[model samples]
Target: MIADSGRSVAFTGHRTYDGTAAESLSAAVERLYGRGFRTFLSGMAVGFDLAAAEAVLTLRAAHPDVRLVAVVPFRGQEERFSPADRVRFLRAVAAADEVEVLAGGYRRGCYAVRNDFLVDRAALVVAWYDGSPGGTRYTLRRALARGREVWNLHPSGGGLAIRPVQPALF
Candidate 1:
């Protein structure tokens, strides 16, 4: 996702860990931050969500003004987080300039609904996709349909490749 001044961006992706994919995602976040993005919205899930939030915090040390917005799908989603992971997540949320929870509890399909909330409010989306048909893929498809620019990070051999989509010129 291309960074725009005073606009927030959202992130979505698989909750599975892939080392190369994680590194690639960090690079993507750094690139966006360098482009003047100051606010990031993330669902605070495992894998990609945690990774993205961590990256944002690391960047914040350098860009003290950068903000990480935790857009949680429900309360106690942090219960699923590991002790250390939960600590980090809580720190991110406390340090966050803003927080928004889309639902009160984990309803069926709540994650997808949360994704839609993020997409609806974001100027762009940064997604990690392994070409699978899951919530992240569904969110990306929705973003495309709505003409939102997306930056998809796909895992390659021990690394990541970025594919960015721009709004079509009429």
Candidate 2:
């Protein structure tokens, strides 16, 4: 649950990556914290989702009041995660102040619908997209259309840097 003054930020992005993108994501989370965000919502997927959740948990060690909410697409989805990632996903869900599964099971097009749910509920979105055309891109587009703030952390074939862009201002 989000505090009255705190903003809820959801995460969406690619599920495959090299090491550089992963590090960039960690830095982006820290940047969000510095900007006064207190709650984070993650879809609990394998790649970017797991990475974002772990970053939030890591920040919790220092900022114990920060909350991580697992917005799962469906129950038992974590079972498909790799052994290490599965452990992290379970930890995230266990440590989260709130866990909401958008659907009872994996229905066709459910992940995309789940992403939309996250986008609708969040005040901001932190995405690690590699310019791919997929669910993450769809979520990013929706976030922009809703006038929500979105911070893109993907490298544009350049050095790793945090680029914060206001979709509404664009």
Candidate 3:
């Protein structure tokens, strides 16, 4: 099922995180929940995606209405991950309320397709970005272009900042 954009949040971030990433993500999730975001979309990649999904799982214990959606680029996307990461990925997928695989197998630009899928369904994006160029930047730019609210949980220490949507430069 396609998520209700008004209530859905998409997450994007780096593949690795620092020590305080977990705590910061958990707090951000809690805040978003309090603001009535019921659905969270995770790209289901290794680092920040897994962290976001796990945080939602933790929150689900107290608020059953919170939904976690794992948006996989393709089936078996985790096959290349290390054994431990593969296990983590499986656990998150199993626990997710909904799993949407965009492709039957890995293909060129599949990851970008997955990212677009998340942004298309979510009105709010929660990002763990340090401003480096990559998928996170691409997704954030897409969200901005589409006028989605983006909350950046800057892992480098600036805390959560809600980015303003810029007016179209047409």
Candidate 4:
């Protein structure tokens, strides 16, 4: 059970990024910790999700109360990952405080389902979206529709500055 949705954050982003994203993301996670967020949810995807999970783990050294929750979309989602990526994926999952696998096998739209699950439980979302249409954008829209605040960590948006994407006025 999530301790507090109000204090929980979900991470979503592109599968690839420049070298600068990791450092900025880490700093963003640390800042969020300072802002009283304790429960962090990761989609367990290859790039940003794994990086976000790792950041949370690193932050635990100084803030042990922080928690990382890995929300996997399916049972063998990591099977397609390269060997090195699989290792990184496993390491993050092993270190997570909680794991929630949404499906026993892969299915169409499982990722959307997983995104919905994360948004349902989080009051905040940290996205590395570049505004292109994709899973990251989908997750961002879902979060915004659910009234969760979003912080875009994409370098194009501005480095390490907590920019909150306000929900649409509609």
Best by lDDT: 4
What is the lDDT ranking, best to worst? Answer: 4, 3, 2, 1
Score residue 9 of candidate 4 by CA lDDT: 93
lDDT per residue, candidate 2, 1-170, as tens digits? Answer: 54542377899877884444556666666777787888899988888887888888988898897788888998789778789878978888998888988888878888987898788888888887777578887888888888888787665521223354433322
Each model's TM-score, in the order given?
0.81, 0.84, 0.89, 0.90
lDDT of 3: 0.83
Cα lDDT tens digits, model 4, 7-108, are: 999999888854456767777887788889999999999888888888899998788899999999999999989898899899999989999999999999
Residue 10's lDDT within candidate 4 is 95
Q: Tell me the deviation in Å of residue 112 in model 1.
A: 1.8
Candidate 1 lDDT over residue span 1-170, tens digit each: 32442377788888885444666676777777777678888888877777888788888888888888888889888988889778977887887767887788888998888888888877778877777667887887887787777787653311223354322210
Q: Which segments of model 4 are wrong by more than 4 Å?
A: 158-170
**Residue pairs in candidate 4 whose N, alpha carbon or C atoms collide under 3 angstroms:** none
What TM-score quantifies how close candidate 2 is to the native fold? 0.84
- lDDT against the true structure, each candidate: 0.74, 0.77, 0.83, 0.84
Worst 10 residues of 2 by lDDT: 157-166
Q: For each predicted model, how many residue pairs clash, with residues at least 3 apart or on different chains?
A: 0, 0, 0, 0
TM-score, cand. 1: 0.81
- lDDT tens digits by residue: candidate 3, 29-94: 888889899999999998888889999999998999999999999999999888988998999999
